[model samples]
Target: MEFDYVIIGAGSAGCVLANRLSADPSLNVGLIEFGGSDQSIFIKMPTALSIPMNMDRFNWGFESVEEPGLNGRRMDCPRGKVLGGSSSINGMVYVRGHACDFEEWREAGASGWGYADVLPYFKKAESWMSGEDTYRGGSGPVKVNNGNNMKLNPLYEAFIKAGNEAGYPITGDYNGFQQEGFGPMHMTVDGGVRASTAKAYLDPVKHRTNLTIMTDMMAEKVILENGVARGIELTSKDGKSETIKVRKEVILAAGSIGSPTLLQRSGVGDAASLSAAGVEPVLDLPGVGQNLQDHLEVYFQYKCKEPLTLNSRLGLVSKGMIGTQWMLFKSGLGATNHFESCGFIRSRKGLKWPDVQYHFLPAAMRYDGRAAFEGHGYQVHVGPNKPSSRGSVSITSPKAAQKPRIQFNYLTTDQDVEDWRNVIRLTREILNQPALDRYRGDEIQPGLSITSDEQIDQWVRENVESAYHPSCTCKMGDRDDTLAVVDSNCSVRGLQNLRVVDSSIFPTIPNGNLNAPTIMVAEKAADHILGKGLLSPIDAPYWIDEDWENRQRPREPKNAMM
Candidate 1:
């Protein structure tokens, strides 16, 4: 098969790129996914997002090889294998990340990636469920919905009070003006179903003449000739290997794990590592699979003393009511994505932006439990906004089907340990706040007696796990930096007609969830590739004021620009 643009992996970024590039009906675009379709019933349910955590069919249930720094215990790392990729399985929290995150990317040699430059792309890709206004877009494939019919978890509100008591102001919407404070989470849902990238971008365009989407097709390696990427050698579902040529470009949107693995397999990685893996090095890029980062999180679980949790409504009556509600009005608990609320807060007073993020769940969740337990319980998931620890991923073999060696050196640095310690403490403080006093219970994870920083650090090393936001493997930087694998445009340093359009190209992980930023990258790259218009931002409408809350949406162009 031959195409104008070949995209590997039907992930968040891949789906967006496919939709944008294939908009021109003349261009032939090919998108490949190693897994099956997103036809699973549970995947479409808003609240069942976590059901994929230990499920093997839709997830690459990769685990670290016991990190010595993390008490020699391996932690589960789940990457979505189906269409839409991780966005299909992730908790549907809509986050654009902190504005400073992109500014930092620009400072680190990624020239055109400052917050101002990326903001327009963010707006271009969003269809705000909250409403169309200055900060939102009205005509985009991806849907962003605020508050579902489910009642707000009280614990989430209490976190806001706690933060205020600690002197932080309430940030109405994290994706809006401020990124500090606790509030109800905005989810990527359309009506009552999951608004995944596949549902929003790929599914709607499946019948398009220019796009060809293949599922269960594994890409083994990029077919490089001399120093340019020409095509890819891949094995189909029946084990038939063939080369698919690309006339224009080969884009690797295969995510953090898949991108690095495919690059190394194609002889575009660190020369020393590729040689050891029985592959000849083509680019000798040392940073191909280095600089791995993830948000480490620990869950503070408690058994509720009252009937406020999901357990209280797990019976037949509630189930029937939820079903009827969804069927009738597209509302109720059935539409809820379990992560009802979240917060961004600093562990102490000195931080510029919040260093810790919280996920409030109204249920007691155990790892891989056989049966669900319901009660009036609330969970505080403490995640480090930015950890200084870094790790790497490498291909263990030349085979396409084999899983790569993912080494997440969690809690490996002093800064990481301190951040985790402070987050855990801050979580406890929020849980013990006056608003949650009636619902609060004994500390079960680390227990209340472990007050010392050393004890807290030890607890973190034993319990903290990945939030699955890996990046910087094929870091984007300037040609001057020898460690740089990809340039600002995401093209490999020494390879022509080859580019990476995924989280793997991030020079560093953004300050919040990565999905939105990954999509923004594709949106911007699409304009750059299509030669649609001037790369500069079209001046913001004078009526679309900086105060987005009170501003009216600018009138849309009749046919919309790509």
Candidate 2:
């Protein structure tokens, strides 16, 4: 197979790249994924986000080697193997983090990727259901909505009020408003159905003559000649090995774990490591698998004394009614994305950026797909939005694409442990608020026994899990950066016509969710590759600005919200 653009891993970024690049009818684009079709009914249902977490058919169920910092427990890191990638299985919370997050990227070597520079691309990729305004884009493929129609619990309301009481302002929109306060989460849903990247971008262009989507094909290696990426070698479903040629460029959108591993296998990584793995070195890019970062959350679950949570409706009759409702109007419980409300907030006073995020669930989340919960329980998941600890992912073998070396040095530093402690303390405070008093129940995880920083640290070590956003493996930076794999324009440093368009290229992890930002990266990268215009600055969202009062001007609600 030959293509003008051979994009690996049709995940969030890959889907967007395929759509934008193939928009030109003359360019042939090949988008490949290692998982099967996204035809499962569970995937279309919003609550089914967890249904595929353990599903090997559509999930690349990879685990990290036992982390000494995390009490020697290996974490299960799920990357979407399907057409939509992690976007399909994620909780669907739409967040771009603080403006300062990108500024840190600019300072770290990714020129033109600061908060002001990436703002327009954010606007360009999003069709804000809330409206077309300064804070949002009206004409984009991906749908963004505040999900205000969904009812929020009184305890949840108190959480926001608690934030206000704690001195954080009420941010009406996390994406539009500042990320420093507490508020309801905005989601990528259309009429309550999950609007994934495949749903937003790929589906519309899948039938285009210039586009080719290949699923169930595991990309094993990139074919490099004279320090340039020519094509890729992959294994088909039947275990047949084959090679695909590229005429112009080979784009690696294989994600944080896959991208770095594939690079090492293709001989474009750390010289000593590649040599140890029995592969000849092509480019001595030391940072290909270094600087790995991910967000970890500790969920506090409690059995609600009142029988009003989603667990109360788990019976057969309620299930039948939900099915009937979905059949009648494509709405109701069946159409709901698991996360109803969440917020980004600072854990301490005087922090420049938000350090914690919350995922307020209507029902208790059972980590293992088959595990059973006690009763109707509500959960508040507290996760550190950004952490200082860094890890790495490396290739262990040259042939088998099944295994990779993933070392998540979680809680490696005292700063990381302290940040998590503050996050836990804040979560406790919110749960103890007056609004949460009505839903009051004893803590099921840490309980009252956990108070000291060391106690919480031990609890977190036992309970913390991945929030599923992994990035910064093949970081984008200046050529002078010895650890840089891609340039600011997403081009691989030493390889010609090879670019990495995925979360792996994020020089620094954003303060919030990574999906929206990843899509924004592709939106900007497309124009960069086409040489359509000079890269421009992206303004921070109006909410995050210091001058929030002036930017919150009135607008046409219908159009702006739409």
Return the TM-score for each candidate structure: 0.92, 0.93
Query: What TM-score does prediction 1 earn?
Result: 0.92
lDDT of 1 by residue, 1-562 (tens): 8999999999899999999899899999999898788887578777566676557888988777888788898877788899999888887777887776776788989988887678788888889866666556777888887645235456556656655554345567778767767766778888888888899888888899999998889999999998988999889979998789999999999998889889999998889999998888888889899988888788887666766677666567976787677667766776767676778865544455666787777776654422234345557777887778888999888897777888878878887777777777666765765566677766666678668898888877777777878877888888777667888777888889999888888888876788888888888877766767634553332111233343211122222211
Residues 1-562 of candidate 2 have per-residue lDDT tens digits of 7999999989899999999999999899999888877777667767566777778877888999999988899999998888889888787778887778888999999988887888888888888876787668888888887554456345456556655554456677777646666677777877667788999999999899999998889898999999778899999888999899999998888899988899899998999999998888999989999989999988787767777677766677977787677667777777766465666766555566677888776666665532237676778778887788999998878974658989979999988998888777767766665556667677776677788878989999999988888999999899788889999989988889889989999988887889999998888888887778854664544444354344221111111100
Predicted structure with the largest lDDT when compared to the true one? 2
Which is the leading candidate under TM-score?
A: 2
lDDT of 1: 0.77
lDDT of 2 at 456: 89
RMSD of each: 7.4, 5.3
